[model samples]
Target: MQITQLPSDQRPREKLLQQGPQALSDAELLAIFFRTGIAGMNAIELAETTLSTHQSLQQLFNASLGDFCQVKGLGEAKYVQLQAVLELSKRFLQESCQRNTVFNSPEHVRHYLSLELKSRQQEVFMVLFLDNQNRLIHQDILFYGTINSASVYPREVVKAVLRHNAAAVIFAHNHPSGVAEPSEADKIITRKLISALALIDVPVLDHLIVADVSVISFAERGLI
Candidate 1:
């Protein structure tokens, strides 16, 4: 059926105008970009086909321009349009990561770092610098390797905290092995970091170890 022939409240574009973008289904939202239909299909039908070809919307977003163009009735122009929207979504996610990250407690820190570190295949040591109000000032990757006492330098931690003028800092690293439990080496490094930061009057707030879907907090466990 023609989209315009549908009830005004049920039409994707009309519903978007009346209720906002969130009111539209994934296929309905996609159909707005599709705009037109070829023989034997309506715009919504074509969109449904496209969505079905790639099992999920995420898979569709991850698909290359060539992949979209290969779809029947979808040409390079529509592929570019879809690619541009996906790129904008990616950029917005990155910007949101920079802006909206708040580390209030151990759980907050874990949630923030999980989004950034959960997918990493190798160990990545990162530091979160916070201001006097505990708002995040900046986050930096300090080291990327096997987590061990020999690899992390306490002096570098001190220097980075000073450079950022951070009142407090949270340390986090990922275990590629998917074990959130801190090893003896991780404990030793946490002690070293706490001691080094203490000398400069910059407090170590927490040390988190991120595994696949879980996190370990040093402060919560009395390890810090």
Candidate 2:
């Protein structure tokens, strides 16, 4: 059936106006972008066919310009429009990252880093920089791989703090073995970092060991 022939209240556009965008199904939302139908299909039918072919909206969004254009009814204009929206979403994520401050609680740090580093095969270290009020200013990746005394430089940590003008810092590293326990090397490095940053007046707040889905705080264990 043509969109114009559909009952006004039953139409996707009408339902969107009456109930809000969230009320629409995935196909209905995509139908709005499609706007028109081919010779034998309505816009909603074309949208359903496209969604069925792609299997998921995520797959559709990830499709390349050429891939999208390969869809019978999706031309260059529609492909570019979809690509622009996807790029805008990515830009918004980057902007959100810049606005986020360092988290204070050990649990919060674990939660934040878990999404970023939990699945990595190699060790990764991140430094959380905080202001005088203990609010997060920024975070930086200091080192990667099996973190050793030789790899993690106190000078680099100090430089990062100075660059961000941070008042305090938290050290975090992931254990690829799925064990959150700190190693002997971990303790030695924490001690050395705490002592080195002390000379520059930037207190080391905590040293965290992150594993698959757990985190251990050195400060909570009185190790730092």
Highest TM-score among the candidates is held by which one? 1
User: Clash pairs of candidate 2?
Assistant: 102-136
Q: Give the alpha carbon lDDT tens digit for every residue of 130-156 in model 2.
A: 888766677778887663322688888
Q: Which candidate comes out best when scored by lDDT?
A: 1
Worst 10 residues of 1 by lDDT: 97-106
RMSD of 1: 5.3
- Give the CA lDDT, 0 to 100, for residue 58 in model 2: 56
Which residue pairs show backbone clashes in model 1?
none
Model 2 earns a TM-score of 0.55
lDDT by residue (tens digit), candidate 1, 9-40 = 98778889999999888888888888887788
Deviation from native of the Cα of residue 162 in model 1, angstroms: 0.7
Candidate 1 ranges with C-alpha deviation above 4 Å: 1-108, 146-150
Q: Please give each candidate's TM-score.
A: 0.60, 0.55
